[model samples]
Target: MEFMMFCRMLVEISFYYSFAGAAAAHFGGGETVLPALLLSVCYILCELLEKHVTAPSAERLQKAGRGESGGAGRFFRYLGLLPAVFWLLLPGMAPADRICFLFPFAYLAAVIWRKDFTLSRYRQTDVFSTFWKAYGIFALTLTIFGGSALLETTVPAALVTVAGSVLLLRALRHGSEVWRHRDYQLRSLFETGLLIAAAWALSRDAVLELLKTVAAAVWNRLLVPVLTVVIVAFSVVFTWLFQLLRYLLTLGHREPQDIGEILQYFTGQGEALTETVVVSDDGSPVWQIVFFVIGILALVILAAVFFRWLLMRAPGEEHAAEQVEKIDHMPPPEDRKAGGIFRNTPAHRIREHYRSYLRCFERQGGTRLPSDTSRELARKTLELAKGTQEGEETLNMHLGRMREIYLRARYRQEVREEDPAEMKRQTSAVKKFLRSRPG
Candidate 1:
């Protein structure tokens, strides 16, 4: 599940970079690498901040049953983007072009930060919906920016989109039991690849031209007019609101001040505030320097505190440890001498015998690491038995038989009627060998 989630995130980030690269290519005269790299860096930073900082804090708060809101953590997360904003500003580009470059990065960051990436919380429909939206944006960007001269940019973007789609499909398939087979996955990929190729071949020229024409028309006829009206209406409303606010601020203080007088007063106050903070003409403001220093210190302090808290064990963990210790010290069931009590179904009986076998092995000083699987443990035991005694083949046979029964019960969810008897026989043979070994 963790692997699948990581793959999904990588696919998302790749699509975002592809779309950003296409837009940067269009606006920056075929220069896509630097802009795409910047966007990718910003995006990855946001994900790290969310995963390591914001998420853990939220989880801890919830666990503690605190009513504290996550607003502060969220604010800090956004604050971390200030350096990226300044980096974008450092480039002397047109305001419109800079905004175009920032839009995809900002949108990607918002999408990633807003969504919880917990595996259990994932929904297939939501993931696919987000993917389609990103793909549409990439296609639109390609259509608008791609021309005969920019085939280099278009080809890379197309390849990235295809790769992302394949990975996302693989993740989807991997999450399901029915479609998890390698052959099934390869078949799906092949079908998707063919579909993408056919679509590209059929729509490479005519469809692209059609889309560009429609986009141009919409921009000229619909978007421009609507934007002009909105700007004009906003200006009028803003002026009215300013006047009302000024009136309220100066109410009963003076008799009907002129608009020019109010503006002059506000400007004077702004200058006063600026002069209070600014200590030099050719350098940054003293307050600005102080603010930067304080922010850095705050970040360092928060990180140290967070790490220290993480190192401390929780009460629940201690309780769980105590419970495990108690279980480890408990006496074995008396039913073990009676060939064990089998209950419920064949699967249950087989599992019970397997557990008994493990306990017996542990009592004989055989350790089972948590990372060892059933088959792995069986192999290790077989190796030990081979080192100690004769009839190695007999011991190997017994272990292999028990391993097969355990695996069938555990994974295949299949237990035949004879599985209980077979499991008992194999387990007894293995345990008998262990009992004969010198302590």
Candidate 2:
């Protein structure tokens, strides 16, 4: 779970930082980009360290009956967010900027308190709600700051990043089902494309005008409380519809991009597609083409060397052998029969019964190997009989019969005649045998 959370944090930080860096670069009044980037990096490192080291150390201290674990852990989590607070509350920032930063920070504290800092709680929270709330905070921040025209441009872009991040997190979580199976991933692409297309449709100028109108209305104090409620309500409705569109687009109904205008609107690449011809006195595109070719070749060569070096230094024979050995020596997982105990399939029902029998045996201090067959497991029961020789023989006979029936039923897929009476009899015998065993 810690490993999974670490991966999630990495993905979250990467997406968030990329967008934040881009937004800062575009609207930072020519401020250096390094501070924002470094702050993000530092926060990520602190989170990773806390999860990997500090939290586990606290757990060990608690297990050892130490009283300082709680205090130590609280201090760590509090310290971890200091970098974010520092960045958000930097000198000269607006009140709204501080609020925007503090809002998520407050949300984090609430989550930690409510969920006891369980990593999965954060992951399981509604991403759509979280995104828009964060978005609303940023919108308010921009309104309060009123420093840059580029600030409004960031709204749609931030929304796009939110969409992508949420989609990516979902994909990564259920990657085996959604990504390994190509159809779902492809669906995600179309969904993402549709989302970006919608953002493009809400052109920058229009969004700016809307924000300005909202800001003006609020400043004029015209039905201020009612306006706030209406704006929040509208934002919710819009986000829900937008999310619904994303959900529906994944149905593989390829929309018609037939008309040139529709294609242009969807792609929104009209400005990007136009090439600027550099007209110099040289009157030649040849030199320009030569420079581009040289640059491409240089990049390719550098990339090849870097990748080759990376591949060569990758985990080698000893590391791989150690990993294999660890896997081989790992204990069997606990029998979690509840998931399939009431499954509707016959196979699952039979497997659940078998697992229950195994659990009984395991509780009696019996160990089963991965390679052990049903016959071997049954034979092992012969050594458990503590009564007279005749009783041992009788127990072995019952166990042998049970094993035979189980093997045929479990392995023979074509066999449809699994007698419930026989299964119940065998289960009872197994339970009786387990109960007879010495602890």
Instruction: Please give, for residues 6-106, the per-residue lDDT of candidate 1 as tens digits.
Output: 33344443444444444445446333334433444454465566556765787789788975546887654555456557767776664434654454455
The TM-score, computed over Cα atoms with residue i paired to residue i, of candidate 2 is 0.29
TM-score of each: 0.31, 0.29
Instruction: Give lDDT tens digits, candidate 2, residues 104-212.
Output: 3443343233322222222222233344565566567766787355454454445444554565456544524445566775676576557545545544456558768
Q: Who wins the lDDT comparison?
A: 1
Candidate 2, pairs of clashing residues: none
* RMSD of candidates 1 onward, in order: 26.9, 26.5
Q: How much is 438 displaced in model 2, in angstroms?
A: 66
Model 1 Cα RMSD, Å? 26.9
Give candidate 2 regions above 4 Å deviation: 1-46, 67-70, 112-126, 129-151, 154-157, 173-439
Q: What C-alpha lDDT values do all the predictions have?
A: 0.55, 0.49
Measured by TM-score, how close is model 1 to the native structure? 0.31
Per-candidate total of colliding backbone pairs: 0, 0
